[model samples]
Target chain A: MAENTAYDRVKAARANNRPTGKDYINALVDNFLELHGDRRFGDDPAIVGGVGWLGGVAVTVIAIEKGRGAKDRLTRNFGAPNPEGYRKALRLMKQAEKFRRPVVCFVDTSGAYCGIEAEERGQGQAIAENLMEMMTLRTPIISVLVGEGGSGGALALAVADEVWMLENSIYSVISPEGCASILWKDSGKAADAAQSLKLTAQDALDMGIIERVLPEKEMGKEGFYSVLRAELCAKIEELEILPLPELTEMRYRRFRALGAQQLAGE
Target chain B: MPFIDFFNFQPKNELEKGGRQSAPIAQDDNEPAKTCPNCHRQIPLSQLWGNDHCCTNCDYHFRMNSRQRVSFMTDSGSFTELYAGLCADDFLRFPGYPKKLETTRNASRETEAVICGTAKIDGRECCLFVMEPYFMMGSMGVAVGEKITRIFEYAAENSLPVVGCTVSGGARMQEGMLSLMQMAKVSGAVKRHSDAGLLYITLITDPTTGGVTASFAMEGDIILAEPGATIGFAGARVIEQTTRKKLPQGFQTSEFLLSHGFVDAIVPRAQQRKTIGSLLKLHSGGAENG
Candidate 1:
């Protein structure tokens, strides 16, 4: 196998054969109960969130599911959530907070769906509300970027006590093709845009945007699941010891410290 | 210079049909002018300023730049700008971006897109941030995000209310992921501010879209918008192309948002100052410890 460039990594992360949120949920979570609907509107299949047991610890599992095959993708909107999807996730998180259960999220999406109906139904408001609410939700959150983390759609679920990304994943504000189209008026230069975006997992970790990168080398499905489960168990154990006020304050400080370096010199 | 082309050029007819009616054009050597899209009448720059940048003939609200906005909303000489020293570096060194930034800075007479400061609205002290659309469409970049975060921090420290006037195209593409991160950064700041029980009001102006709409702009405690302002996360053209459907007229306008319960109110340009002052007064009774 050839070594992956940033663009190649993006392609691989988005490939249909790659492991998705559903795969991770089935592998790492036991006795999963899938929740549905925002209660205000219909359920969004793109966002699958529910209660589950992770290593015998009750946890709230929320993941963006891109779906398998054409029909599934159509139903899931290719992991690009609508407003209802975010609302559903918010409902699950709030429920988790009430129960004192830790929240785990799998982030993988091209972006939020930008259809006319989504905008009219308050897509931006939905995402913004999630960000605000998640900050003070009074529960530990661990978000893993399993694949493509594009723009605000990804960030909507990514405000966590800990944010990890798969080694092969790529996260950026805009997709490389979108960036190329906007910058050069040519989507063909996506490779160049990918390099400029600095969206690799390693780059994100170095920039303090993400907490850790889970390496994919020589790890079979079972091995990957075991490692992820151990990590989650350890993190939850550590977070469970902290007081709620302290945990929420730490989360707030973590976000407040981002982008301080660039502003320091000035 | 093509004298025959000058004679062939039709002005008012093309202006009426095109959406560039709000665009300022040099009608004469005396004063720059703009055509009111609603009434199709030429309004002089001085007259427009006197009318609070609204059309005198039909009361259509025109977009105001950050300095104009600050001057209009704040008491004279009461605005003390914070984080004016912060500017974006060419981290990516994208082609032509440096030159473009310089050009925009020289043209707009501002260092970055957003102006953050402490100001008074009708004797009520508050922190204010006004986005300048003329400066690269008021795009949020690293510096813009930093400034907004700093303002929120400042407001939280002093326990002052935050009043933001948003007019943005989106995140700046030149800065890549750094620009997009502003959404999270600013939203986090708004969260902190709100957690402190400080009042935060966002005044959505013309053409607020993309990451700005998806973040702090939409997180306001009392979301106010200017009458007839276009506000949405995605542009109408993009949505139309994606959905393959014709949108209803005034789909993303402030009126539409008010009807849809997204905005608390749509204050016209004339009443905006008074409305803001009234809100500040009403909310100013409580102490910082609340």
Candidate 2:
């Protein structure tokens, strides 16, 4: 049976057994050291950021974590980040740039947390600062979409040299239910909205929104982590070799060209 | 059978010597009397327009189209529009997008949600972009992003100061991830403009939230907001639903932002030109003296 509908993939991405950000971090990174607090505010459990060794190469790792089970997910705010989470990620990213270490990010969230406290703490400004700084971070950076890559929240960590997505993952400006309700005034039409969103990893790759679609055949097994680890190491090493100007310039150009079809033809 | 009157076009009370402000009787829709949402006073449209689209009664600021904003913000006959008439495609062929664009184009008379160009404000030249509220609430789709990015790049190359006004419902969802990419793209442009040592000022208008806020709107060197404008990282309704707490009065208003130190100043519509002009004069690098 062919099981390749967009809605199917969306559900699969949110499956209970799917590996979360911590799973990837625990598997791929060695000598992991956890860092906390955004310096300006309290620490957010939704985002985990610190230095770690990836194939013996020191790098700063940040992941938006959706903890497994009810209690854990509640503790992590279901992986939706607060302003402090993004700030913490930015702090680590800046530190990574200073030490000439590569920055790796694992993004999986429904979106940034929408709350009175988040708004009061300046979620927009926090994300905006990350976007501006990450654009020219002066270091090799890679972002992998392990699950849902929700709008600006995910994007705060994803203005990278290369953004990759797992096969069943989805990245969208808004969730299908939200989009359906807003556009058609019918949340029941989410499947149709999902089809229209072009949110699948393959769609993202086709649109040049992302660089790669990581296959999910052996996803939860030991072989999956080893393969991903090898690929990440090789890719980051290649990216690290580029001169700083070229590296940042390339990163800028990558995002600059996404919706910029007008420039080429004109 | 009694004859029935089908149409009723009469006011509640016939004409008489009116109250304190019988200043001008509006005859029809063209010269209609608009009621202020704040003061609940009936004021003529012309009087409101004359007062910079703010309520003459309670000073409630009304939303202005890009052209009206540009006309008032710039010197007379100084704006030269750039990146005009760029086509917007239903790139992903999202449901109803093509038809929505068609209706929106017909209604708003703007090809895009933003109008960008170079303008002279108070005798000082700068690159300017004003978001048009009539079009999709000035949503930043591909075209809006392209125009904004071009303006910033142009300003950087010309060594011109940039002034922009932003109002949006965030990234346009019809365009999907492509719409979201604009945030990063425009921020890159802003970064380059900042790196060039030129000033970029953003005048945030009513309801500047979502993707716009998280990107170029907040990236301005000097950020200003209109009085009574709602400025926030998240939508108030969304926050209320998420937090399930009663939001405090004046929670995300311009005054709140000013108090919170997120905004540099809460400039009223009447004082915006003078304040911006003074800032520009200060940052003009002795050009005025020369």
Please provide TM-scores, in order, for all candidate models, with all chains considered together: 0.92, 0.93
- Report the C-alpha lDDT of model 1 over B1-290, residue by residue, as the tens digit: 49987767665665555857575665565788899988999899888999999998899998888999999999889999998878877777777788998999899999999999999997789999999999999999988998999999999999999999999988887877767777777887898889888999999999899899999899999999998899998888778877889999889999988888899999988888889988888888866433
Report the C-alpha lDDT of model 1 over A1-266, residue by residue, as the tens digit.
23678898999789898888999999999999999999998899999999889998999999999999999999999999999999999999999999999999999999999887798789989988888888878999999999899888998998899999989888897888988987889999999999888889987887788889998874337988999999999999999999999998898787777666655335
What alpha-carbon RMSD in Å does predicted model 1 have with respect to the real structure?
7.9
Candidate 2 off by > 4 Å: A1-3, A262-266, B1-30, B287-290
> Could you report the DockQ of all the candidates, in the order they appear?
0.51, 0.53
Model 2 chain B scores worst on lDDT over the 10 consecutive residues at: B1-10
Q: Give the per-residue lDDT digits (tens) of candidate 2, residues A1-266.
A: 13699988888888878999999999999989999989988999999998899998999999999999999999999999999999999999999999999999999998999988888888899999999999999999999999999899999999999999999999999889889989989989999999999899998999898989999999989999999999999999999899999999999889888787633113
CA-based DockQ, model 1: 0.51
Measured with C-alpha atoms, the lDDT of residue A169 in candidate 1 is: 89
In model 2, state the lDDT of residue A140: 98
